[model samples]
Target: MKMSKAAVLQEYQKPLQICEFPLNEELQPGEALARVEMAGICGTDVHLWKGELPIPVPVILGHESAGRIAKLGAGLERDWTGQALQEGDRVVWASSIVCGECYYCRIKRTPTRCLKRKAYGISYCSNEAPHLRGGYAEWILLRAGTSIFKLPDNLPFESIVGAGCALNTALHGVERIGLEMGDTVVIQGAGPVGLAALAVAIESGAAKTVVVGGPAHRLQMALEFGADAVVSLEEFPTAAVRLEEVRRHTGEFGADVVLECVGHPSAVPEGFELCRDGGKYLVLGQYANAGNVEFNPHVITKKQLTVMGSWAFEPRHVLGAIQFLARPRWRELFAKQVTHRFSLDQASEALDTVRRLEAGKAVILP
Candidate 1:
């Protein structure tokens, strides 16, 4: 009998309790078991730890991951893209599984908004059957409908684990705003999601991309990821100063698009101010309701800015991200973003590193 180790979050704002449990060796009809090789800790996990994002307790916390197929069930013989799946094939799976019967899934055709959606690590409680549903564990059980993509041999694990879901999240945001060629884009925040947005914007043929965020390392990464200019909060120190620099790049007018990837409610007003009148503003980072801010609604009307908020990403977006990473140009920059790693037992430490902004991306090797 095989046993698996996992870090279970029993309480918010506390250390994760490590536990060992028996693995479910038998795969049900369409299910598969993956031996988790690397699992990336995301900003959402930090929010979940602080009790900012409400979720069921006693969950294994990790969603951004890639692994090798350990056991393929009776029915699922191929990957999501229809490639044959065999034991030991490197792969990455989509985080959320939607109920096709939901109104959002069926009527609106926006399955990402499925009312009964269950996400791995976020929605699944460890008490449930097939207990290893999250990447923080040594194994993850892929349920039916979960789209898995086989990784190409040349693509390094750092490329997939580097951007993780942030790439797909950025992909969905760019898709929502319909960013076009030669557009000027200003990306606010230099975290994983922000960096991902910058890379995607540049790849989409934006003439110029300016990144506003801080400390020093993240801003440097923004430059490496192909930002035309970067505004470090260490230098600007205030929203007003940062806005001035961003406006300078946009000339007399503001940026054609402003991506709010900071997730702070207060950043919305700043991002709005950086956008040109009639420009587009895509809120990609506020996937979690961290808090609220008092902003003048008049700005939205006066600027005539097209506002769009992207939630979690769909499987297609993940497919798009994988394709994006396969490109050598993007992979080089993304591979630079992977800055730290820890063992499964060091899950809490990894989360702490991310919470403190100590690393670009932290992954757990189980």
Candidate 2:
């Protein structure tokens, strides 16, 4: 057994413990070992820590990770040897493994929705040894069937880590929304995913892009990233008031597309109102346990509005996210989004910081 340092969650709504754990050295053919360099703390991680989402405890938590390929399993050595990968080559991995035989996979109807899906930091397959999974660790053992991509030589590790999970979600949401040139778009929430959606909307040629919701810094970042207008939700106590304010800034009608990046149930009804007649509403945020909201059915039927939902991204979205980050301007965006960085030992503190909305995005460097 090889020893590795990891931050393990011991209980719900509790601090994570930084402990030494035993890892299996025997890797299955096609597997690889990655020495983790950086892992971004996502809002979902905060949800899990707060017991808002049910992820198994005693688990090492981290999904947005980038690292270096340290060692390759037996048969993988030859294929990976000189192909942009080496003992210290930088890399980032797709977050989950899907069962290829599942019905969704067979029909090509969202493979990420496969019943046998296993997430790196959340769910573990039975065949995987405990230490072979998760990113909040000194070393992670990549199992077979995992999709690993080499990072561009010029890309900063923090940039890739910051863009990891959020960008993929943004890409998927934008694909679902199908934004067109000269379309008016409003993104709810100014967090990482919201800001990402805003960026993609602007890149998609949206004539006017508005970002609503805030903590000041995120709204500022949205403006920097090309948002035509930014609004702080704290000013409006009611959804109708917020919608009125949004309409005043936008045309008298409303936005052509509304993207909800705030997972709070309260935002769902407001998001629907932000979309104009014959517009689309995209829900990109992952809501916690059974939250309910009230919405007028007449608004959907009368306006001919399309309500869409997007979960984790597919492989194509992952590739698109990587390409989006390939642009030179992404360096500035990454630097702006990541406001806090903590060692793996301070995982709980980092998570708390995110929960309290203390930063735009917090990262954990192992």
Candidate 3:
């Protein structure tokens, strides 16, 4: 007879309605429940709110969260990494569950592209069974097929949720287009994904990194996360000027790798211009189709660029992110990116903070 409260998105471009649900004292086989500690507001959530992505309404909206295990089902005894799961163990779980029989899942063996995949916060309806399916709630029910991983005791909730899905999304993108030792990287957005990509690139042994994006705080965080140079959009104020600033840090030929983490199609042309002729251009930030852009296809041929796009992350990337963040310095750096916190009822405000790009990171302490 345990009741939990959650912030449900009743409609797009509308305030999230606070709702309550009852949790079963006994969990079904292969399921687990966690008491949500912190749920990070992701850029994707903001996109969903704007009706950019078609998500089921009356849905609870928080994909990146960490919590203490409350109850383990009959057969669910271990985390994704095979660690034993106890009631009090700290954990984070995958956002989506894929259908194993899909063409993308079975034939291609690429589950990330599974068209039938259902994400916790994005896909599930609030009225569905095990109603507390998102982290914007007091509790999140880790469904049967979801990969739940137990976090180490030393890792704080803020650090794991700080980067939110950005870390794993960046991880997948990096893996999709490999980063080399001593390569120069230019990250074209100072958002969470860009910052996480910067960290990942530096960790992967990039000789230099330049970040382009900003108000002021996000650029500062990029520096803290270890960027060699930062191009302030405010200072540059134009794509042409920012391109020049990026080239200054990267030298005459521009960076070896340029990451488009700006989530807008308009940034695509700049990404092309920011890469060295034969280098790579990675597009990972356009999760939702913002609009059309008029980038020249001739540049792809002229530059001989290895153009790549990473859609979303796989569960293994989550494990990779956890292992990467386990480092004390990394954990601390990411945790520092958390600039705003709100209660579950303030979910709309949290989304607004992210929408305006006001915080390095915003979270709901449900």
Candidate 4:
């Protein structure tokens, strides 16, 4: 057996250790091995490293990855879209696998709410066999039933990895709120998720878009991504002032829709304030259990708001995001989102960069 080097998280809040595990040269009946190209360091990865989210230890961290097919399982010849698969084809796989028989999957018709979901790079353990299950490694093992997507020859890898899961997640939230054409949208946060939400709002025909939350560079990217106006967190500095700016950019009536992508519980109340009467609010950034905040329910009642939340992206959303990024204009801008790159051994530094909001989108090139 050959060994694959992986940066493993042996303990919480400590630097990831570079370790070697035996590589499975021969895949199982329905498995495929991908030679990892790039792995994106998401904000959730920072939360996982700080032990803020529950995850298996001794794990290879990274979920957003785009790579080429190293090899396919014996007799498995087609991708999820029924595309013929061959060795060395570029691909991107869905991060989570859901049980189809679950209540959320079968009854609720929302597999994103599936309780028994296992995600690559987050749940998979490096201590186990086929340890190269995560993206922060030279290789990723796509097990049986993994939703493998073959990339079009024209779509650049940078576009896929730069948007990464953020685009997929924003797609989920945007769809849930049912953004109307010509709707005025106020998006909270200026990180990858918020930026992606801004892109979606513009693509969805939002008449006016305001992006709130920033640290200068990210706000600039939001503007470049086609935001009508941006409210800098450093300038506004408070929820009251930020809400005032949003109303100013919009009309006397706030916005038709508000998206909370800040990943903080405190963002919820402000999200309500930003929405117009009968407006919609979609929260997608509370991906982790980041406690609760006190919000007045009377606000929802008085505003007659339609508030909803989308937990994470489904396989379809992942495919949609990829196709969206493949467009000529989007392909160029979203690809530029990958501002920082790191080697696999520098996973800890990559995590810190995301934690400190220093990169547009940090990716690991193995």
RMSD of each: 1.0, 2.2, 1.1, 1.0
In candidate 4, what are the lDDT values of residues 1-366, reduced to their tens digit? 788888889998899999988888888888999999999999988888888889889899989998999888986798878999999999999999999999999998988778899999999888888788899999889888889999998988889998989899999889888988899999999999999999999999999999998899999999999999999989998988888888999998999999999998999998999999999999889888778899999999999999998887888987898789778888988899989989988988988899999999999998
- The CA-based lDDT of model 4 is what? 0.90
Residue-level lDDT of model 2, residues 1-366, one tens digit each, is 678998877787888888777777677888888999998888888777777866666778888888988887776653211344567878888888888898888787778789888788777522335554788888888877777777778878878777768889899889987999999999999898898898889889999988998888878888888899988877776777888889988888899999999878878788888889999999889645537778888888988999999888876676777678878887568656888999988888899899888888898889
Report lDDT (Cα) of residue 68, candidate 2.
88
Per-prediction tally of clashes? 0, 0, 0, 0
For candidate 3, the clash count comes to 0
- Per-residue lDDT tens digits for candidate 3, residues 176-272, read 8899999999999999999999999999999999999887999999998999999998899988888888888899898899989999888889889
Name the regions of candidate 4 deviating beyond 4 angstroms.
none
TM-score of each: 0.98, 0.95, 0.98, 0.98
Cα lDDT, all candidates: 0.90, 0.81, 0.91, 0.90
Ranked by TM-score, the better of candidates 2 and 4 is 4
For residue 264, give model 1's deviation from the true position in Å.
1.1
Query: lDDT score, residue 50, model 4?
Result: 80
Worst 10 residues of 3 by lDDT: 288-297
